[model samples]
Target: MENEVNTAGRPGSFRFIHAADLHIDSPLRGLSRYAGAPVERLRNATRRALENLVDLALAERVQFVLLAGDLYDRDWPDFHTGLFFREQMVRLGRADIAVFIVQGNHDAQGTITRELPLPAHVKVFSSRSAETVHLAALGVAIHGRSFPQREVPEDFVPQYPDALPGQFNIGMLHTSLTGAAGHDTYAPTDIATLKTRGYDYWALGHVHARAVECESPRVVFPGNLQGRHANETGPKGCELVTQSGGQMEARFVPLDVVRWHQLTVALDGVESLAQATQTISVALAEAVVGAGDRLHALRVHLTGRTPLHTTEAQQPGTLEAAVHAAAQDVAGAELWIEQVHLQLASPIDRARLAQGDDAVAELLRLVDELAADPAALVAWSSKACGDVLHKLPAEAKAETDWSDLQALRELLADAEATLLARLGGAV
Candidate 1:
């Protein structure tokens, strides 16, 4: 319903919703440590997003809905999760909107063995082998296979049947597709292999980020229905696709209830911490306005070199309190400060300081050397910190990869900032 409709090519047409990675009831990861986090709202986001999906299907009068994978986070502790899913399926059933699903790693046979009597309108593909379901009325053939276990190292595309000559053949897969940034490899296969597989379209899952791999015979990942954490930021939603003749039109519909955002306020040449608070307040107001109507969970990172780093010591908790206060009056929209990262630095010209012969310059040079070389930084970390990464809390370590070169560089910059803040008084 979002994009411009294309009706020029041919009269033959149909509309369907494509969504994936509905990690229902999965708590927003790494938010528990933060005080006053929107734990409840985000925890229920997936369910609400699913409700939005069903509502869209009914409202648009789509032929069918495709839930590519990861319908559940894991094996449900109780029957509530299963019941909620079935209730939505029943809603779709009453409206005659069919749903096709393939279980991803989280809801695989071995991972989530729990059983439920889903509505007849909902057809979950086989886990043991590739299964094809024919929607004779719509002339659509959907082929897919669920994950038998938690991890699938092999390719399932090779096993999928060839495209039917007269029908629109769609391949539903839960794959990492050779690999993705944060996810492990599952159902690994190349794009070339998928293109040659003879499917009209590919609806892929497992990767939370949306990607359209091909256009000729459309291939896509609709991303997750909702954002479960800070890492999965921005507008989270599904693809509303309309296929007519040889042309396909796809529109991304944002269905997320609580949108995750990372806002950075550079202190720069601000006179005082209180002055920066005014800036922070204005930024929060603008961010809320920009986010439209839905709730925004913000992780604010205040960065920049400023004399306010030393000034911050005058009023210990002023910055943190100001951040929370800014979100209090968001007019019509609602917002929550998930966490405040004070990644600020003292107003020191380090490049000039490094030109000196003092102890400070020597220290600055050593920091520079480590910052420039990734291997040196790792070696310094190993010898100096004694398994520093392992010592950190699991949640904290999961947020950052200390070993990666770029990540290490960022980490060094952060550490350097902290040191500058500490020595600001002396300077």
Candidate 2:
């Protein structure tokens, strides 16, 4: 770790874009299988998002761009992915905007076999060790290292060189940074360690949610440029950073052409499907307005205690269709419902039932016990679905992991919801 500084060139103020997890040419998971889904648009979403990123860089006239990691999604499916990326790089190059990148876990050196010649302006950091790129013209220094393998269990921060003195220093890394939920811990380190490196800004990736760990040093995760699934909902984009008078300021800029949203609509007093549809329509309209000109892919969760619970549970497909129809009718911008979840509460007094020494109470207690225990839930589900499992084709059976705790948890929740809905009507 050398503490070398190259203080050259006149720099009063400068601006650059910091982006990560481009996942270029990657398709949004599980959307294509749904009916009425804009498969073509979704399939091209990453490409379009990359194009938008380039457009923003060109339009903003940023001196350079920092891509933290995960530029490709699990290696190249084909050469077209690499070519598309090269084209975007060329676009940036023509505008004289250099792109500095460090490959994350998803696109580690060994993972991506195919390669295309990127524009001269693009500089991918070496996977062997931490390397620094000095932009003499901008009086800035960027230090980064690509992941050599998919899983980086060890902290590599110590290996990074000390920040250059008298220059605006930036450190680019792809890490989970002390274990973020829903993300694997990769290149794990602490914010304190990053701050001690004396870098002006830390451009981080791997975690798909935007966050600013520290404002003074400006450690930031721009998040993914696009939301690739339901879990990754909300506005996805990059950070536009400006350096003036030795102070760095960052602003989030949305680059996703199509946005994914998860909306919860309460139906507390709703009694009929018509009212539900109307409520959903209003919610969709609001979402459309909020989304601006971007197309929206939404998953609507219908919640709250309602008399329509039984009807919704029994005819979910119909309800979902109606919700989709409502979206189509009221949405000023283009919208599609990825799914409609019915989480309507039963009218039955569950607390009172739990207190009683009756068969229903016993059953409820057993269900609660099973839901808490993953092993019990898995055993129960396997026994319950034994006949269905036997009938499943070999390929399907191979693909299904029957012991998955997450899957069992979801199954139990759905079953509990349905059972409560039916029991409420009978009671």
Query: Which candidate number has the best TM-score?
Result: 2
Q: In model 1, which runs have C-alpha deviations exceeding 4 angstroms?
A: 1-12, 29-32, 244-247, 313-316, 351-425
lDDT (Cα atoms) of all candidates against the true structure: 0.82, 0.82
**Candidate 2, after superposition: displacement of residue 27 in Å?**
4.4
Model 1: per-residue Cα lDDT over 19-83, one tens digit each: 99999988556767777776777788899999999998999999999998899998999899999
Clashes of 2: 0
lDDT of 2 by residue, 1-427 (tens): 1111222223557889999999987755555447888888887888899899999999999999999999988778788889988988999999889999999999999899988888789999999999999887678889999999998998888899998877788899999999898999999999889878888788999989988877657778888999887788878888887776655556788888888888999988888878888998998888767667887989898888876766655655666776887886884588878878766676667677867797677767877899888788988998988999899777667767988887776666567666765665443
Q: Give candidate 1's error at residue 19 in angstroms.
A: 0.7
**Clashes in model 1: which pairs?**
none
Per-candidate clash tally: 0, 0
